[model samples]
Target: MQKIVDTAKGLEGLKRQWGVHAAGVILSRDPLVDVLPIHKREQDGAIITQWDMGACESIGLLKMDFLGLRNLTILDDCLDAIRENRGEDVVLEQLPLDDKPTYELLARGDTLGVFQFDGGPMRALLRSMIPDNFEDISAVGALYRPGPMGANAHNEYADRKNNRKPVVPIHPELAESLADILGDTYGLIVYQEQVMAIAQKVAGYTLGKADLLRRAMGKKKKEILDKEFQPFSAGMKEQGYTDAAIKTLWDILVPFSDYAFNKAHSAAYGVVSYWTAYLKANYPAEYMSGLLTSVGDDKDKSAVYLAECRRMGIKVLPPDVNESMARFAAVGQDIRFGLAAVRNVGTNVVEAIRRCRKEKGAYTDFYDFLRKVDAVACNKKTIESLIKAGAFDSMGHPRKGLLAIHADAIDSFLDIKRNEAVGQYDLFGDAFGGGDDAVGAGMVVTPQIPAGEWDKGDLLTFEREMLGLYVSDHPLFGVEHVLTAAADMTIGALAEESSVGDGAVVTLAGILSGVQRRITKQGRAWASATLEDLGGAVEVLFFPNTYEIVGQYIAEDAIVVVKGRVDRRDDQPRLMAMDMSLPDITAADEVKPVVLALPRPGARRRWSSGCARC
Candidate 1:
């Protein structure tokens, strides 16, 4: 142990290895080697330094962090979609700063697709803030963080913004310097840049030195703070400020500076938030199309956004071979689910299909499509996938009919094209060439479609199979409100707050997407069911006792309430079922009342096995 301690002590604080900083970058006017110890990153072979970012900064170098944002891509896609659909370039700069509809949308907390303000806590803050303009929006971006939001700064912000509390000045003498800048935020220093601005205004510090002052305050270094205070106090005294006023101002700066955000970054995010709100307010279909595309690969995320689309009265069509593209797109006012999102649908195939659609018009029914396209690219498997995704519904037939035809129709269509390759030769010289004449005339009769319509359960099942989500309808669509009330939380909400400690009690509602039975070590039967609704999906473990007590309640496509303690044994959280009941039915009305195996107050026994989320 003593030898190991000595080795670790030698290793500690030493640059034992080099690693890339995700956001940190070092800048210097001179050659990097002259300024700091430099090297090539072994992993990527990029030029890097052995010195840490802070070390580089301390030695007269600039280090800037670049925040990677997925929303920026989403916003760009939304704007491009808007322009394509609306035929107007929506000038972002020309937008009204105090747009009423935008603020109204924000205040109502309908920020599912909005940037920076879509999270649960942020939305809750928005509801109380009831922001009327851009300033409040900017303040929201700055305050909704672990520091300010945790400190309940949002409450004070809301109170001041809503006129519930008066905007208190930092100091009567410095009010003029502070008023214009801090007026909107109720004089609370919510931004780091505000500290600099406040120092410049109240303490008469130059912008550069004021920035240094902010840096010192953020680091809370006594030596730097002591040096910064001299010029700050002296400058305030030179500006005819009394010592008492300066002391009061400096006292406020110390604590608030720790959590204060950078106004520039916050305002940038705030502008993005407004842009998202604007898109949602006016071009909802386009906005949702972008949102859906952004999360197309994630079924859970796609489901949440799709639900939001439905709530916005936008119809989401399943992947259509005729209209669907490689990415989610808005057709008129409805969002078409992308073919790329379809399970087993390859990107190459999607590209091929989209390229073909762009080259010619939409496919001329199933057989015309079958005959014209590359048979190798869009093979039987691809056709089957398209059918399952309801992509062939636009061909004047049900998906089942398309399925029936693909087995024979593709061959017959190919045969016509094959026969045309020989130019309809009948032992004559004139017919001995591959001609457009024969190829153009090659047409097969449309095969008879099945008379019966595919069952709704089967159709939705197919859509779910292909899209990883129900496109036409979900099992618990209309009863969302009832389910919401019955369950302690929705599947989506549960997913967001899944970091809660294990054995935490929670109730959630969703259709039984899947159910798998197993035999325990004790030879007792148990089941694990996937409870999924519009919001999201969660796994529920029903042990032998719970399974036997309410086994009938657990069936596929049935909207059931799951009451259980959170089993966060896995990376993903799952609910160990203690209770299960259908929506609109009272718990007492259930066949067998809920008998949860909650750990007794003085006991140490555990209930169920670990679960896998669906």
Candidate 2:
């Protein structure tokens, strides 16, 4: 055991693997190959330096990080969509920083898809701060991290910004010098740049030396911090600052340096965050379409954006063969689901559909679509998926009716094409049809079936199966009142950072799906299910004790009310079920009256005598 312990200690700080940085690149005046060891990456054969970023920097080489942000791509797509759909050229760089609508959107906490302010806690902070300008956005980004949040800096910043708390300088002696540096952040030390500026102005340190002090403070090394403080204090005293003021400033710098973010970096993020909010405020459909298209393949992400769209009052129509493109597109004031997002539908099929629509105009009907679509791409499975996904609904056919007749329609269309390939003419072709167009039309007859549609639940299930979500309506639509009356919060609220703390009891009502029962190592049965409300879905766990009582009610598509303690161990919250019951609208609607009667002496005897007389 001693030998093992010694070996583990020796390996604690040793490098275990070599990895390439995601975005970091080393720059050198001389050829990199001549200056440093280099090798080709095994995965892509890209040239890479042997030394890591810190090692390269230590040798006087410049290391630059070129980050590829998805939000930037989303912005580009959104701008193009706005130009194409609305004929508006929206240049993000030229967008006004003080746009009133943008600030209003942030103030309302409707930042579900905005870049930096989209998280629940960040949204709540934005609401509390009621950011009225770009500076507030940057400060919120800097203060939302664990370190600042743990220190309650975000709340303090919010309070200061909203005038709930007064902003005061660190020291009256250095007030004039520090205000210029920290005024934008409501007198809070939010940025590393501010720290450097403070040292330069109040302590009379050179810019380079102040930066060294900033780095030393940021590292939080006792020895380095202790050494850096002597010069800071000496310089402050030389500048006529009192010893007490210097000590007070030093006390703040020591702890705050740990979480102070780079002001420039926060401002850069603020620009992108503002751009997204601006576009969402002005062109919601275009922006949401771009956002949905960016995550079209990811169902969970798509569901989140879809919910956001609903909240924005933008209707996200289901996939329509004529209206939808390969990816999500803005259709007037609404957004249309993309054909490529439908399960079992390939890009090739979506391309074929688009090509056919462009070449032959909008699909007139289901029969016309079958005749004009590329037969090679429009296979039986693809057609069925499109039908189930509501892609063919605009052709005036019920989804169930189309599903019933699609096979025969495809077979009949194929037969006509086969005959045409063989150069065979029907005996009654010319007699029934005068020209090629008429002959083609007369070859395959559209099948007629009952006009009945599937039940709401079945339709939603098919949409979930094919489109990965319910677009026409959600399962919790009609039962919302009942759920609202019983549940403490929605499933989506569980995802918010500020919604509930760990182990806090909460009640939620939603339709249960994906229920799985398993036996624990202790040979006890336990279960897990996804509880989905209108807002979103959350996982609910039923341990052995709870499972024994609620096992009978646990099944797929079961609408149940769950009472549980929130488990926020993961990035998202899950519910540890304490009780579960079916959502009963009748029971929820019943208002039992409380008949209270004051107790009287001999009341029981009087009631018994009255009953005997009766």
TM, every model: 0.82, 0.88
Each prediction's whole-model lDDT (CA): 0.77, 0.84
lDDT of 1: 0.77
Tens digit of lDDT per residue, candidate 2, span 272-385?
999999999999999999998888766667788898898788999999989888788898999998888888888888888898789878888887787777766547898899
Model 1 residue pairs with clashes = 192-261
Per-residue lDDT of model 1, residues 347-407, tens digit only: 8888878776777667777765765565454477778888888887877777877787787
Clashes of 2: 0
Stretches off by above 4 angstroms in model 1 are: 1-9, 12-18, 41-43, 169-181, 197-210, 220-252, 355-361, 414-447, 498-503, 518-527, 543-548, 567-573, 584-614
What RMSD, rounded to one decimal, does every model reach? Answer: 9.9, 9.8
Model 1 Cα displacement at 195 (Å)? 2.3
